[model samples]
Target: MSMDINEVPSVDPKEEPHAAPPRGNLRKYDPLDMESASFSTHHGQAAKATDWMTILQLAFQSIGVVYGDIGTSPLYVYSSTFTDGIKHKDDILGVLSLILYTITLLPLIKYVFIVLRANDNGDGGTFALYSLICRYAKVGMLPSQQAEDAEVSNYQLDLPNNRFRRASRVKSTLENSKFAKYLLLFITLLGTSMVIGDGVLTPCISVLSAVGGITQATSAMTEGRVVWVSVGILICLFVVQRFGTDKVGYSFAPIITIWFLFIGGIGIFNFVNYDPSVAKAFNPKYIIDYFRRNKKDAWISLGGIVLAITGTEAMFADLGHFNVRSIQISMCTVTFPSIILAYMGQASYLRTHMEDVGETFYKSIPGPLYWPMFVVAVMAAIIASQAMISGTFAIIQQSLSLGCFPLVKIVHTSPKHEGQVYIPEINYLLMLACVAVTVGFRTTQKIGNAYGIAVVFVMTLTSALLVLIMILIWKTHIALIIGYVIIFCSVELLYLSSVLYKFVDGGYLPLAFAAILMVVMYVWNYVYRKKYTYELDNKVSPHKLKEIADNLNFHRIPGIALFYSELVQGIPPIFKHYVANVPSLHSVLVFVSIKSLPISKVPQDERFLFCRVEPRELAVFRCVVRYGYKDFHERDSFQEILVDRLKEFIREEQWISPPTISSNGDVNGNAMDNGEVTNEEEEIRRKEIVGREIELVETEYNAGVVHLLGENEVVASQGSNIGKRILIDYAFNFLRRNLRQRDEVFDIPHKRLLKVGMTYEL
Candidate 1:
């Protein structure tokens, strides 16, 4: 059973207060002690037993949340591949083989079997991989981390010894290098940014491709009309994001399920009726023969061929929302077979009716099911967009919590689901970008290329991160790691090279988006580091805090004030800003610092680290509140919980005070018969002393609580270089100013808040 250190035994308050111990005698609080910390706020519960019904229910639910994006890929895979137009009979079998292998190898084998299990606790993504690597190594860029953080419940891992010299050297090298840390962060952010790019292009292409089916159904439906319709649908899809995914998951799962069933049913019909020879494409020879027949075109067509597994990353990225089993079960049983059959069925149709290559997906749809398929296709496209949008929100949320991205407003749309977040700024921005792609490109082929670029690049990054995980985290053998890297890298790089080849033809879009977001992330992280460094270097000493406490002119007001700090220890310079300007502070001042740890979830009991500053009569305390990326801070009751925990800390500290040994093994302010206080009588005396302190705190508890935050801004000094000036003054500052109200992020009430305005120059 876990210990709650705050559950100190009650003591009688009728006795006298103990005399204060000498400055050097008291036991300084150790925040690193895993046994003593306790918190009132509950983040998440532990996993429960997984019965068959629960697994089946979650598996069905995973269809909507996890597989939407990948399931919709069939709408455009064949169409995109034949953009130059499918001219040869062998090309049909070849393209189908490429699609089958790409889907079979990457998503089904690499992701479902390997990468899904690599999740940080229940979380997964590029960030999760990064988090996993960070836990096993000292490569984390966050400054406030301690050695004890590694031993936390979720982040804990046993390391291989120095006997494995190569691995040891590699780990040491990665930990020691500043460049390596930043590079890893840059790469992770790039992957996340590409997912944002996916958010933009996936909707455009999916919707456009789905709506294009109308062109086949009727002569009146023009490409222009289809584009407009797609844009409208994209608008609707993004607007409803405020409602949250959990609210709509039930509805979306059925549509996607029925859509998959319809496509699979049609696939069986076509394979049986049109060309059973399409089954031969499942063999590796056709993929080789297609390349052998048309080498250059085959290489370039890989840009198109990769559309088969476009949104497969979403399956892995959204693993936090849906577990690995449900995703794997849904994909293997339904999504995977349905999509494979859909492509094979398309291939079968293409062998005989070669003229309909561009419209093969729609044309191949059995005539009776065409209209129903189009409607389901549209719904599936919308569902696909919804999944990517939710994923974008999650990635941004993680980035924000990790301090890599500028602050943005995050709304938890569902009370029950912690991960179901919606970002208005990101949503509207994505909508505009999606609309622009549809308006400008107006064709699925160009948009498909852009989408392919985003998808393949994210895959490549995931593969790169996985190699490090296989080495450091999993501690796999060197031979196995090398083989994993080579195989995955070769395939991903092939697709990556194909996408890069089309840079001039719509592929530049995702690249541009990635570059822009990378710059934003890099700049924000740069400013964050500089600001953190300043706080660390310029912190107020314990002597200075004592002096502040001793001075009478700095009036102590009647309420409890929670002063927010960026530093884990010592006083932040922002406190200096406030003290210099203001004549008074609260009667009880609590220095509060919130840190995001590399772990997925910091257990509630271990969340807050409370330490009492010297001269307890002055009522000053410091708290370090830690959270993982997935942990959501409940805004409404956080202050109340924090105050209650503070009360608990004070009581616990008071109770532990006299019994705690001083230097040379003597108990502070107590007589030691033989280097220790005598048993029963001394214990009762200590209890009486603690009860007195509790009463004092109870008197101050009647006072209200106020929150203090720093309104910090970054500026480039005049003497700085033009490059620095442009980055800090223009780019980073603009994003900081316009993104969100940083003060609002804490959800502190305006009336009870104190904002100490400050500026820093680089």
Candidate 2:
């Protein structure tokens, strides 16, 4: 059996490797050993865990929805290079070759090859990177997230005390934690915020870009109502999102596959038409010629080239949700080749009609095929926008989880599917923001004018942090730093520079927004850290500790006392007071606190806390709570655990504290919400957040800390209303514990679940 009462084994969804301790070393706590160091400095353990599918699914979904923009740029690349407006000397083959390189190197090589590989505990994006650094990186001066589980303790929650009934309910509550829900909500909100910008821009730009694309296919319909058609299609696209992605999503992968084939086919047809020279683009001579021969027009060419690489940042940020390997597979297999071919095809068509400035390009694909292609283009564009939208949610959760932001409400959207999550307040606000962005931008050209920079800035931030992770945390030699820094920073900088070139052309807007977001998140997180880290109790009193040891049953197991402490040197404030009252302390006591890590992997030397602070029988047992960044926290969990260890610690002189009564005059207990605490439950919530209530609070009147040590060995069933005090503690052998719980089992109601309408992958 698992050692901790709060430890729930993984289920089918347990397919994701949890951040729990290994079976052999799970630690349970005891409160009776006042001098026992249960939670202090101990970190000697080593184990590695992997779950590639969960990693990929999460990464893909996060960025696929919002980052799809960069993913589908292939739709335009093939044609853009061939169009007469580009003024390139390359034939179809040359254009095709160039397109191949662009797709391969920029998106695949720079991001997936390097950037995407750096994950913050399977969390991605710039902020996730920030959190990882703050927590574990030993970079000369960076602070870490060694703070308490403020979100849990900050909010006031009442735990019931019908003894057996309450313990049973609390066990169930602790087993199903709350981290996952909060994370989903936070990330979803952030993604939606970005999409509000994309929703408007994508409609105007993607459709218009495709319409402009038609002008590259052939020359028949360039003079007519392209604007009207584009606008009409965009309207329909926006309306469809309300229905959700489930039905549409079933066909998403296949449809995209077919679209890839269509893209390659068009490229091949154009290649055959002119048998274009592959060597032309490679010379660097043509690029020089274009600049020297037409210096005035080169800026526009640069702008167009820059557009080709705009979505790469989203590619990296979304990699965590889509696992690096799957992204590599998907891109190499379908997304990449098609993009290259499409670009080549567009280039080939442009070569055939050298005299035409975009006129012949549109006229080339002269049939009903344009409508289907148009729909595909719109669908792909929406997919791109959605990827970023979803990423926002993931980003927020990660940020909050790593202490970048305060707590917010998180709601799980899927029953069994861990990835299907939704946030209503976040959703409605995102919709409003997305619609506003779509209407505000009004054109892809305009949106494009401002896009690319926010992500690049994020990319820059990530690269800087990655350098810190690789060199400092990983402890690589200086020899590797040059090559790593040179290659990573160079590519990121080149793209960022391109984005910078467009700053005046409207790029500053995104950078400005990114800055604002960073500030707000940083401030909230900082405030919460300080508040939660403050003295948990202003003072620990001897009187309270005295009454606690006097009031309960002692177990036969090895007696242990576990208390958390701030500094390793001094005794815990509570313990100082605890020993004064109990007089007789346990044989061994423990002090504990989490030794957080960026990777969260336990090292070989830091697992168990065994130190002789005093002597053989009297020692301080300490432990450092080491777990994954994605795990959640629970309350009263450790206390119930001592109940079992009481059975194990048969020789120690550990005494128990009586369960305290609430100020409301009732024995209160219970979890405020449902479900296990995944990142979904442990939203990167801030401590200073108002409104939400803490689970437990110590007021002036109810000034005692209650500790329960298992099935009641003694009976002090009721308090006679006044000044009389009883001195006898009886073992309640007649009080049937199992019978009371069995009767209450059917009394609890199941949680009701409602869907937020999220399945539109179609």
Candidate 3:
């Protein structure tokens, strides 16, 4: 049977109803604690501009954070494209034509117009797209998803029944085929890894290219000095990342704004003075003519020509920080026109002075403005690097939330900006890699070769994923989908092929980085799945719990204990192992499961879900806390919020039922009939019982609270093959030991925490 798109089963329900009243077990709390808890039905939607002033402000801020990388492309595109020297003035127009068409088609039309609309509740990037697909289908491998996850504000999608029927078929094919699922995951990871690679290369190339202009300004500075100077600037740039993007954007907005104006003004000057004839490059015919005349040389030159759109992917990846309209406004108004003007000016300059092709940007500058523009160019380059670095952090955060990457310490740097994050581990590693690449490559040409490969590969993967999204999520028409694939994918593939040709000449660098990152991501996800599956198979059942309680001399202690596990439905096997080793149990037990949903933020009112486990007299309950990938959890407040919610649940349950006597003179805990009891008397009795239960919960909570965490050791099964041993015993274990642990992630107080050791052979 096919499931409706909205009917895909959640891993576990928010609340399960009970048919019977609670047994008179004074030691146990009320069984209907979850029934009265509030669950907000509010659906998350993308942020929108409410007024023109806000839109204008966001657009201004976006120029720094969103357009930095693409805006700075004017610095090197002309020089990189004509690395072999311009043979004819027409070659300049041909390359300019290619640049114009690429920016217009890819960034302006494809991403801003179409792909931006595909964002997952304002969140974008390869992982966000994958997240949307996962939500619509049962393709996600993670086992901890909860039914409450779909209720997250941004997780809801409204589709007509007819569209859903078509989407369901697409979803069915992916769910039924294991290979297809893996392929989709692999493609997403490949794109994510490339974006991470972009993080490293962007800083190296941008700073290096901008700093290289020093040699043109003064003959005194050598290439070696330029490399060191670039390294120093990169170190400073990465160091300031801890201040977060909000501050960075505020500071950078003016520099990038001025830089764009300067470049555009210079382009206009050069166009009028040298060659207004270069304006013919705006025509698409020149693109065909340029390739027709140059043939092999033109095809190879595309490797460098592709650099013009290096930062286009950032527009989508960083969409979580700024709304679509603001980004679109920034791009069309300031970014697009300025870049076009800058390139036109460079082409005009190159038309007259072909020999200056080596230092096109610096040489074209008027003598009076040379030093001033150079300073702005370097700062602008740093801003461009900032965009990619921020994008890398965002994608990695998404990957970690989905369990594809190993756990790392993620610090949400801005309380106001949900997407502004700082990852210390990734930041330092990227710094080292960027500095190393800058020092080693020492020139924009070689670094540009590597940069093009990463950029096009990510773009091509995006196009491929977008095709599936159109079919499965958007339910776009077959004809429109076909046209999209043909136009965007064809252009991306052309660039991909060209960049691949330079594999031996520095293109291998990003691919090597991507390969290592991809393996790390895949292995972490693989081991995570195996470990979860083992837990699921070996989970402790209610009957098993009864047996353990009866035979193991189990005795209830005087405090509340929270047992943390990955499972959402049943008691984790680690709890059984803990009981086997230690016979005593806490007076109240809560199986706490924390999960990250794919959306950007879970509403505060809907963050916690309470469910009562069976045999409620044992005082056992389950609490599931859900967070969006962008949500920040305050370590100290968790205990307080949980306690407050539990108390509220207790008070609510008392009012739901009032004490009543049966014919045999037993307290049946049912409502009293109007004739049997006065309304005032019943109200007093209800308040008394409610007060008693509330006092009991508070006393027990004050006694003590302990956090129980599982410290699991995963290994290949005894009879497993060599491949499993290598992956599980060596690779997975090494990463698990080196990366962040569960205790650290949750930030549980060390004095109140207990570790339960268990072994999983999977």
Report the number of clashing residue pairs per model: 0, 128, 2
Alpha carbon lDDT of each predicted model: 0.78, 0.43, 0.82
Per-model TM-score on C-alpha atoms: 0.91, 0.58, 0.91
How would you encode candidate 3's per-residue C-alpha lDDT over 342-399 as one tens digit per residue? Answer: 9999999889999999889999999999999999999999999988898999899888
Q: For model 3, give the RMSD to the true fold.
A: 4.5
2 against 3, candidate with superior TM-score? 3
Which has the higher lDDT value, candidate number 1 or candidate number 2?
A: 1
Q: Between prediction 1 and prediction 3, which has the larger lDDT?
A: 3
Off by over 4 Å in 2: 1-67, 75-84, 87-100, 135-204, 207-251, 283-285, 294-300, 354-368, 412-421, 474-480, 533-762
Candidate 1: tens digits of C-alpha lDDT, residues 608-716: 7777665555677788788887788768888777777777776555434444433344335443556454555565665665666566556665777778887777788
Model 1 ranges with Cα > 4 A deviation: 1-46, 654-685
